[model samples]
Target chain A: EPEVTQTPSHQVTQMGQEVILRCVPISNHLYFYWYRQILGQKVEFLVSFYNNEISEKSEIFDDQFSVERPDGSNFTLKIRSTKLEDSAMYFCASSEAALNTEAFFGQGTRLTVV
Target chain B: AQTVTQSQPEMSVQEAETVTLSCTYDTSENNYYLFWYKQPPSRQMILVIRQEAYKQQNATENRFSVNFQKAAKSFSLKISDSQLGDTAMYFCALRGNFGNEKLTFGTGTRLTIIP
Candidate 1:
């Protein structure tokens, strides 16, 4: 089965440095999303994208955070400057459409900020 | 956007026993979908089952099943013949039918099937 795949299953960055997490959604998927979960916390939505534009974003998705689908298959999330609280597992997910469909998730990129 | 809530933080079940994970969601949309995902220690999340809001009959997949109540906005997951491999974090998610809305996931319930 085709699945969403993310690169660098683990990432480490300096507190003030930048990081870009890359993901390749299912080939035919139209909707993509980025979510994060702090250790021992609930998964929180960061942003969603469709048709090369962002659809919706949560409060946590501020100026420092940006998502881009540079090409047909690759979707990337960039954090301009990382913070300690930014340390968490970042997930990339995709679905066939915006409507009633199940979104598949990647193994996740564990970002550790020091 | 929708919100999913899982009340139980942790649960334990004996091997081969049945266990239910409680979940309730709040969504204004009439048409949508609900799902249960299993996240093992490998950090990979696998879809366990799904329930369409329009379907009155509960959905089942082998040993996994869902009780989807549209009236109450509740969707719970039940695992039968639990095995040690069943030990993982179970998350209930809600997705809206409108727009490319992302799924709203619950905090997750850690389930352990004791041998």
Candidate 2:
């Protein structure tokens, strides 16, 4: 089955440095999303992207976070300044359509900021 | 704001036994979708099953089934003939059928299938 693929299964970055997590969603899907889960916490929605732009974002998706469909197949999340608290597992997901269809998730990128 | 609650933080079941994980959600919208996602040690979130709010008939996928109580706003997952491979973190999620709505996920239940 076709699946969303994320790069760098694990990443280690210095605090205050910039980091960009990349994802290649399923080719035919129209919607893309970025979510994060802190250790032992529930998954939190960060942002949703459609039509090459952000359609919605949560309060946790503040100034430091930005998502881009840099190309037809690549969706990327960039964090300008990483904080210690930013350490978590970041998941990328896509759906054929929004809301109605089930969203398929990638294996997730473990971001570790020290 | 919508929220999903998984009351049980952890649960264990003997191999080949049946186990049920509880999930309750709060949503104002009438039409929505509910899902159970399984995350193994690999950390890959896999969709186990889904239930549409408008449908009264519960959704089942193989040994994985759900008891969806629309009126009570409850959606629980039942895993029968549980195997050792079933050990994972299960999350119940909810999403409204409206525009640009993101999925809301529960804290998750850590399930262990003992051999």
Using lDDT as the measure, the top candidate is 2
Model 1: per-residue Cα lDDT over B7-81, one tens digit each: 999999999999999999998888888889999888788899988888899999999998877888888899999
Q: Give one digit per residue, the lDDT tens place, for model 1 in A77-112.
A: 999999999999999999897776788899899999
lDDT to native, each model: 0.90, 0.94
TM-score versus the correct structure, for each prediction: 0.96, 0.99
Error of 1 at B30 (Å): 1.3
Q: Candidate 2's error at A80, in angstroms?
A: 0.3
What tens digits encode model 2's per-residue C-alpha lDDT throughout B1-115? 7999999999999999999999999988889999999999998999999998989999999999999999899999999999999999999999986674799999999999999
Q: CAPRI band of model 1?
A: medium
lDDT at position A16, candidate 2: 100
Docking class of 2: high
> Which candidate comes out best when scored by TM-score?
2
